[model samples]
Target: MITKQSVIGFIGTGVMGKSMARNLQKEGFPLHVYTRTKEKAAELIEHGAVWKNSVQELAASSDVIITMVGYPQDVEEVYFGEAGILENAKEHTYVIDMTTSKPSLAVDIYRKAKEKNIFALDAPVSGGDIGAKNGTLAIMVGGDEDVFQRMMPIFEVLGENIRLQGGAGSGQHTKLANQITIASNMIGVCEAIVYAKKAGLNPEKVLESISTGAAGSFSLSKLGPRMLKGDFAPGFYVKHFIKDMTIALESAKEMGLSTPGLELSLRLYKELAEKGEADSGTQALIKLFE
Candidate 1:
């Protein structure tokens, strides 16, 4: 059973991972962190997290391991090889991959981990960097119900809205559904701002009227102002968002789904990336409209 005494190993200390790991530490869990870049884990180290030199070292020592790496390939690298978590983690160690990756990969990880008596879960999260910083992320989990129950304490420490969707890969499937909604919603959000500005209406005032009504959304309320102020910072990277859309699009096609909105959004994001805005925030899509 997981408790405050469980040593939690966290990999990928990027914009979202860093804050999520820090929250786990604040709740008094002993944290061991590893990232490809040592400098990224520096702050966590200074804040009393134990730093491991590699994934193997961290896996061997920790009771529970959490990974928030970029891309499915990175997930495979951290969990598949002889040096990976499945080989190195102690028997029955609970390994959770919170990265938004392909559902099939999550299922593969689950089967390999189960073979070695490891408990694996795909527990991808939403709410972006702000949600990570605030500990209010919506965590969608996929695993055995008993395992999900066992990890509730740890999940509670990291997020407020946590649910076990179904078996292995369900979490990833749910996250893709989330990205699909956001992909289309982002386009609407950008268009609304552009229309208000072009028509000589104060966009801020217009937002005040529409944001609380039927047109309101997280993208409009949280990111709309950032677009207006030219704050194209990386709350979530465009390159990563594009990666997610590509995965979603591929998954949709495999299921015989036609997603015109998703297709359009993907095309626009690719165009933005081609113009060197790949590292910018999703809110930076407003630049295309401008």
Candidate 2:
């Protein structure tokens, strides 16, 4: 039996946030949502969500606050900066940031939440926009075990995989690992499909063959097909993925760690963005080569 009294508040509605909030609504949770782009909040509002005029207002009224903004800075601004969650924090607030952002930022926010006696979890997620739309993200969470337990039901609503990595920034760091693997795999899919196109072997057919082999991956199977058809309408914006990569690089440098593969991915994504597909979905990265 879950507590029905908890009202869920969500920030960042561009893609993931919208779907996640809608899922909560479907599960019979009263939802309040705040988005920088107010227009994006329309569909969710139609689904029975109340429009939170601002992050602070959302923070004030909700029992649990979830964030899924685009970048590390956006996460920071919504949670701790002016007009942010902290501006309207009340006792016993549970704040979860599900953005794929820098680990250190997660740590800083966690500490701030603790000082205010609020429960904060750094819970970055995977599974992209498609998953969000379908209510199946993979959540990597870090915080107190009790709080993690408290959030499990909500996690079950939003993600397929709900993992507890460690405390404070562990979720974000784990998400970095997830991003690193994705960077490599996305590049792999792009290269393989590009080669198939050049060879006139039918990129889709080649994908059908290898997608069941050891090279099989979610990217190669789902996103690879999308890339092949040039359907890059933002399953996770290239711009947003690049921002996540930048967060990974910054965190790696701070830890005195080196990631050459991620560096190459950064460069490739930068070039892709430079070619003007940054606003497109991560699959649109293949456009750089086309």
Candidate 3:
């Protein structure tokens, strides 16, 4: 059972991970941190998070390890090698991969973790940096019921909407579904604002009206203003969103599902990335229209 006394080790202190870790620390969980770039973790270190030099060291010392790295490759790198979490963490330690990664990878991690008697969960999140900072992310978890219950205290510190989706890779599958929805919705959000501006309508006032109507969406209400103001700072990066869309596209293909909108969005984002806005926030998609 995880308690406040359980030592939490966090990996990947980028835009979202840093905030998530800070919230955990604020809730008084003893925190140990590791990241490829030590500089990104400076704030947490100053706030009393013990910094580990590598994944092995952090895994060896932590009772619960939460990873919010960038990609599936990074997830595998941190969890599968000689210096990885599975090899270094003590048996029965709860390991949660919060990275938005492959469902297959999540299942593989669960199986390998079971072989070593380590508990594993794929708990990806939504609401981006804002949610991470505010501790209101929608956490979609894939793991055993008992384990989810045991980790509730920890999850509560990081998010308000939390649910056990199913076994093994379900959390990742759910996150893919979320990304698919966002992929298409973003295009529409960008188009609406562009149209409003071109038609001489005040986009802000238009948003104020439509944001609460059938046209309402998180992207519209939140990222819409960001688009209007040309504030493209990444609440979620265009590059990462591209990675997610590619993954979702692959997964959809494997399932014999067709995602026309997802495909169109992916094509547009790749064009945006090629034009050198990959590092920009996803709201920058509006620039394609501009």
Candidate 4:
């Protein structure tokens, strides 16, 4: 029963979270925000989001809490720490985690939340920075179906294509599958550009020829131009991409599935990370070829 009157608490105001939180504000929900760095949330604060000094305070006051933090460890800390969400959220409050994290952790949070009569959802999203700013992300959710339905209005505000994949942790599993595709796709995008360059064809012209054809993909169409212009800035960070691939690799191993392509992509990303490109975007994989 999320309404315009529901007090929304948002934690994590980084590259994507800031825009996502802004959209919620635009929809007229009163937003309470908490981030590790208060300055990171200055714009939202200026736009009428009240900044809470602690997670416990935000959880206690908010009707619906959304988190888009970094790393599985960070997720664990925010939800399970001494002053964490589960410890402080009011009964019947809805807690949604939008971070790309392990499915097991999502299930764990769901179980813990249910014991306290709270509604918990793992609703990881795709589409990176551009998607966040444009409100065109694809949100994959896992939780009780009724709870998913309850959060549709909020989801609609933040994403274009939203789906309830299944029960607890399903959203994270689906996100892992999405990351698997992107892992291979990013490599292909990098190789295509590198191949075009080596063959003395103008890579931009080559992109024009193939981008609309079967070879076209999100990475090629969106991140390819950035590659051509040597804009290795992060639409999504290499460290985060590596974290995702590592999770996918571990998840695949658990399911007794083979993921050779994902493995190779992980290796390449690890190489780039080792070379101190960890803060760069995934498209910076082209640096490997250079």
Candidate 5:
């Protein structure tokens, strides 16, 4: 049972982070939030979250600091910058990063946190904006089992499924595996939607049939209708998805693994982003085919 005394410091109020923080707050944890823009902090504040001005301020005050920032650079700034969390983090703090960043960066941050006797985890998450909003995200966490278990109740408020996959950087690795599947799945859903539209079948009916079968995917069931409607509002931004795919491909290259399909998917997403689709939802990949 997490109390109001547990100051939930969430350092990234972007689409998914905001929803995750809002859900945590709704479940009764007092929140301390920081984002680059004050305007971006607006929604969280209205939902019973207290806004903090800087990452260090959030770190110094909070019992548990959770970061959901974007990219490797964003993670660095939040945890290791001049006024970063690491520089100011107090003892008995459990620092959890929910960012989908490079595994190497996660390892670097974890070592630094350990030197300070702070318990930190690389706990990246999946299930997109909808999942974050609904508190049903599938979380992949990597930390000491004791720290992971201690944080379990808090994670329960933010995600439907949580697993402590392994140590150090395992969460990010699991997230890469997750992105590999999501990339392939998005392509399948995109092609299916395009094919159904041209074949004179109501894509919705086709969606119903495929969804209950083994052919089903989250993309097909949740985002297919929106793709058919041509609405590109973000459920998961194409930019973020492309970043995850690129990270997975880089990891594959380092380990000498073959993933031609992921390479192809990465290229397609880059083309979509270059054509100005970065901010749109991943479902907008269907527009690339159209």
Candidate 6:
């Protein structure tokens, strides 16, 4: 039921956020944008998006506010601080956080927003930069069913696969599960290429063979090509991936579960980070073998 007149305030303009916000603009939604560095948001402003003075100002002005920021701490600062979203948004405003963050934080945001008579959803996404650019992200949502249903039209413009997993923090929990798989899968993708090189097989041909079979995955098909091409520019940052793995590990421990593969992946990624590869794209994991 959200129309083009529903002003959208978007905080975060890096990587995927830029494209995601652009898609909303393309859908004719009036957009208000803000980022730490105003220069980073210039592109959106040039494309008819309005610039906001601060998070508080943006929250006060928009009908729906979406945040896709970095790290759990950033999420906390923007939502829980004195002049934050929960403090300034009007009653019944929809606040959707698309950041991959701690589930407990998401639940806390939901509870806090509800106390203010606001509608909130934790909607974490996957599919990376390509998906963001192509408007095909898989959005996992956790919130009231009624609010989710009302937001479906907006979700449709921003993503292809959208699902409501449960209430409050469930979307973040689901995203942590996703990160667990990607952590191990990235290792597998790197190893498969390494093994191919060791055995004197063309890694590209190996990719051709395995990518269509049971070994196929989003990482193998997409990131594998970037690896073969030696393009390590980040579609997703190694540092961010490490943060995700750390969260997943913490959450798993809370549940009294063990994730050995996740543990191994985190160790290796931390090694890469120590090597100063933190800003490089996640496909750079293959460089550990080379």
| Backbone clash count, each prediction separately | 0, 0, 0, 0, 0, 0
Q: Least lDDT summed over 10 consecutive residues: which range in candidate 3?
A: 1-10
**Candidate 4 lDDT over residue span 32-134, tens digit each:** 9999999999999999999999999999999999999999999999999679999999999999999999999999999999999999999999999999998
Candidate 4 Cα deviation (angstroms), residue 191: 0.9
RMSD of each: 0.7, 1.5, 0.6, 0.8, 1.3, 0.7
lDDT of each structure?
Answer: 0.95, 0.86, 0.96, 0.95, 0.88, 0.95
TM-score of each: 0.99, 0.96, 0.99, 0.98, 0.97, 0.99
What tens digits encode model 1's per-residue C-alpha lDDT throughout 216-246? 8889899999998999998899999999999
Off by over 4 Å in 5: none
| Alpha carbon deviation, residue 192, candidate 6 (Å) | 0.6
What is candidate 3's TM-score against the reference?
Answer: 0.99
Give candidate 6's TM-score.
0.99
Candidate 5: residue 143 lDDT (0-100): 75
> 96 in model 4: Cα distance from truth in Å?
0.4
lDDT of 3: 0.96
Residue 138, model 5, lDDT: 96
Q: Encode model 6's per-residue lDDT on 154-232: one tens digit a residue.
A: 8998899999999999999999999999999999999999999999999999999999999999999999999999999
Model 4 misplaced regions, further than 4 Å: none
What's the CA error at residue 15 for candidate 1, in Å? Answer: 0.3
Model 3 agreement with the true structure over 1-290: per-residue lDDT tens digits:
77788999999999999999999999999999999999999999999999999999999999999999998999999999899999999999999999999999999999999999999999999998999999999999998999899899999989999999999999999999999999999999999988998999999999999999998999999999998888999999999999999999999999999999999999999999999999999999988898
Which segments of model 6 are wrong by more than 4 Å? none
Residue 169, model 5, lDDT: 95
Q: List the residue pairs that clash in candidate 4.
A: none
| lDDT digits (tens) for residues 15-96 of candidate 2 | 7788888888898898898888889989989888899788888999999999988877788788877677876779789999
